[model samples]
Target chain A: MIAELVLAMLFGLLLLGIHRKVIARIQRRPGPPVWQEILHAAKFSFKTTWVPATASGALFAGIVLVAVGIWTAAFFVMMTGGSLLIIFGIYMLHKIVEHAFGLSSGSPYGKFGGVRSVISAASEIPLFVSVAVIGLFTGSLELTEITAWEAVHGPLFFTAFPAVVAMYLVLLSKMPFGPFSIVESKELVSGYKTEHFGAWRAGLEVCNGLKTTVLLATFLLVFAGQLPVLWMVIGMILLTVSLSFACAVTPMLSPFDSVTIQSLVTALMLVYAGIVFTGVLP
Target chain B: MGSLGGIPLYVLEFGDELVYFSPYTITLFLLALTFTLLAIVSRPERQVDVAFGGDAYTTKIISVDEMRFRRFMAIACGLASMGAMVTGDVFNFTLFTAMVGITNVGIVAAVKSPHVQDAAYQYGLVALSATVPLFGAAALYAAATGSLSMIELAKGTLPAVPLVAKALLVIGVVGEGMAPFYAAKAEMFRAPGAPYVIMCSLSSLLIFLRVAEVVMIG
Candidate 1:
């Protein structure tokens, strides 16, 4: 567990630099150098911290720490257990904690962002149910179990093809590409992070990096489990490249009106359920 | 237990020691190259245009109110998708996908017309009509096949009952995809090309769900 945590944090740092570089390349500008992310982290540590007059200082600090700490811890746990259900629950807790911190800041933007986070949380239900269904079919909730089943069963794709498609769609939403990026739009002037600066900002950045790494690792452990270790590493690298490409090509979606998001989610659920029942997936 | 179809649940036998080979590594590298080439060469042009150039058509700046709505939906879609994908459950996967797709289409349609209210009503009706039949078909398929294993049906080696069931499943998948496209068109042509918002949300949901499903189910 200790080894996994260390590895995850290290990988998170590495990916942060990679993410910055990729974003820069995508925007048609020379971004800050690769080592810039590390430098920023170091700079943040030395910077003076501030407390809002209206906020509970110790509580505020604790919230941020708890949010980041819990997420990081969850990542390690996920690596060790390789259980899909447990991992999902931990990540959800992480998200909720982050939102709490945002709300604690007492800023209008933060409050609104927190509300949006709740909405996002609500939308996750169907996808959550879908994955549970997968567990039901495979007769196991452990990541390792699913992988072994796939190896023995010759890929669930042949049987649960629609479920596969649905899974892909869910991935797109979770990583929040394009339209799903409503939570982190620049126009909202940074949304939940509007009031945060200096070290707090830096912490969030690091956490974001960690979040990215965790999601990537989870994706690998879930989908490409049969790949040899080296190939899994390669796949992670490939995923980074793809994410960069997606960030470059896709426009940010607005989150002002959730009706569309809700409708799409509903439609997807019904369709996916229909497919599973019909037995047409192969 | 007696062997079913002459296959054992566990087999533990090795003739050779496990070792990493540099040549095998090179083969993977080569395979990656081929995969990239294929992805680039066979890329669909329509998707590229929609993804990269859709913003150019917009004439008005998005209002703050609109931005808020977009943010709400994006986060909602993103979280929902993430949750479903990670659950690694079949039911959650299907339910989330359909929900995300329908909601996206409805929103797009509602925003696209001079009469937002009318558009929403119409879209809602359409979604209802489209989805109900699909569900019925799927249920029928499930009943006829008498086999609950998705893996077997996907193999295309299922008995007669399952074959018909599988055909219905395909229709349902295609229908879900259509809801978003229709919504996108409504947002683009009727509204102010706000389909990108719906599309992005759907894309995020789709990607997370796909990777998770593949790992868990595949």
Candidate 2:
């Protein structure tokens, strides 16, 4: 279990690093190596660390543990093939964690980032509906059962294409420079993360890595069914590259527009779910 | 999902009130407990408000009275969410969910800022209206199924839970604190107390997850 977590952290950071490299190439800029984020976590860990006097010291510090702890739990949930509801719940809770990160420090920029994270809550709603769609199709909500169902009935991507698209959009929202990622847009100066530094920031990085890994692997497992470890890694990279391409080509939406587009996608998905639930499309 | 590990076992029960903690609820319960514990022991952060286009900034300190009240509300919100996470009856879930809504509004209602107060008032109105559908769904479940027990409902032996009731449950939850109505919620988060304000969001998310599992299984 420990090895799996460590591997997830490292590989997730590598995927994030490659994501930057891909976007840079698309934009005709040289990007840092794929190890940059790993190095970033290390460098931040070694830097001098102190809690800001203006900050709520305990929450400002403790929120980082909550952030990492929830994601670690999410990692374990996926590892055990428990339930998609738990995984998505933890992901949505991260929004609150982001808000806490910003508010705990009491920084205006961080506050704006945190507020944007709250607005971005629409992004995660689609994942719940995706879970609903998958459950409707597969007759089960556990990953183990879902994969087994897929093995017997072919991939859910074919049967539940709208859900696949919704899940893909959910993935895109979390990509660093995506049009939907207004929370981390350049104006906020690292957004919710601006207040965290040193070890705290390192912990956040670790959480992000684990989150990216869990989400990517989940999409792969749910939509494509089970695969060998090597194939799973390859699939995750391909998925990350596609998300990177989307992030690189489009400019970040204004916060209002970002929320608007996500809400619209959610509406579309809801309509699709309604149709499926009512036997209109089945 | 409907059921973790595709099994059901009530961990504890007393009379009509009981608790069931699937692997799913266990995580949520732990998370709520963790946040509540933080609220109990931590001091509120002094918020830093910056003057745009300049380096000047000032820290806003929370007063003792405000801290005490908001801490109580936050802990109440956390405990309510924990109840929503593990309760065995549909009505109990709704009751816990409604309690969470009330406490969420209370969490920021003490702030001196008119902005947060105004947001809290509006959110309170929405939350008040939400309980209409929330209690209605719970009542509808008992009427249609002849029992409020989730274990009975999940057995698939009771008259199939009405799709309208399920939809109503989701609607009630979304009304409590989902993103579409998050304009007010975002404003509420603008209040200075970090540990307390976050409980509002965490509780809603937990309740939503639990209800998702509830509706799916029923």
Best model per TM-score: 2
Candidate 1 reaches a DockQ of 0.02
Over A54-155, each residue of candidate 2 has an lDDT whose tens digit, in order, gives 788888899999999999999998998878877888888888888888878877878888888887875566556878888878878898999999999999
Angstrom error of the Cα, residue A157, model 1: value is 5.8
- Runs in model 2 deviating more than 4 A are A280-282, B1-10, B52-55, B178-181
Model 1 spans > 4 angstroms off: A156-178, A256-259, A277-282, B1-218
Chain A only: give the TM-score of model 1.
Answer: 0.83
Residue B111, candidate 2: how far off, in angstroms?
A: 0.7
For model 1, residues A1-282, the per-residue Cα lDDT tens digits are 657665566566666567567777888879778667667766876788786543434434554665567566557645654456545654544444444444445554554454455455445535565554566456666666777877777656565555555555445454533445555566656666666667886776567657766777766666555677678667776776666666667776555354356446657766766666456334
Model 1 CAPRI quality: incorrect
Over the stretch B1-218, how does candidate 1's per-residue lDDT look in tens digits? 01001111232222221112121112222222222232222211111112355554212333455544544544444444443333222334445556655554544443424565465455555545545544554465456544333333334464544334334433443454343333333322123322223233233324333433322322
Q: B1-218 in candidate 2: lDDT tens per residue? A: 25542354446887988788777788888989998988887888888877789989878888999999999999889889999988888999999988988898898788888888888888889889998999999989988989888877777788988888988988888778652236745668778888888787778777877887888766
DockQ of the two-chain complex in candidate 2 = 0.65
User: Each candidate's TM vs. the true structure?
Assistant: 0.53, 0.96
Listed in order, the DockQ scores are 0.02, 0.65
Q: What lDDT does the true structure give each of the candidates?
A: 0.48, 0.85
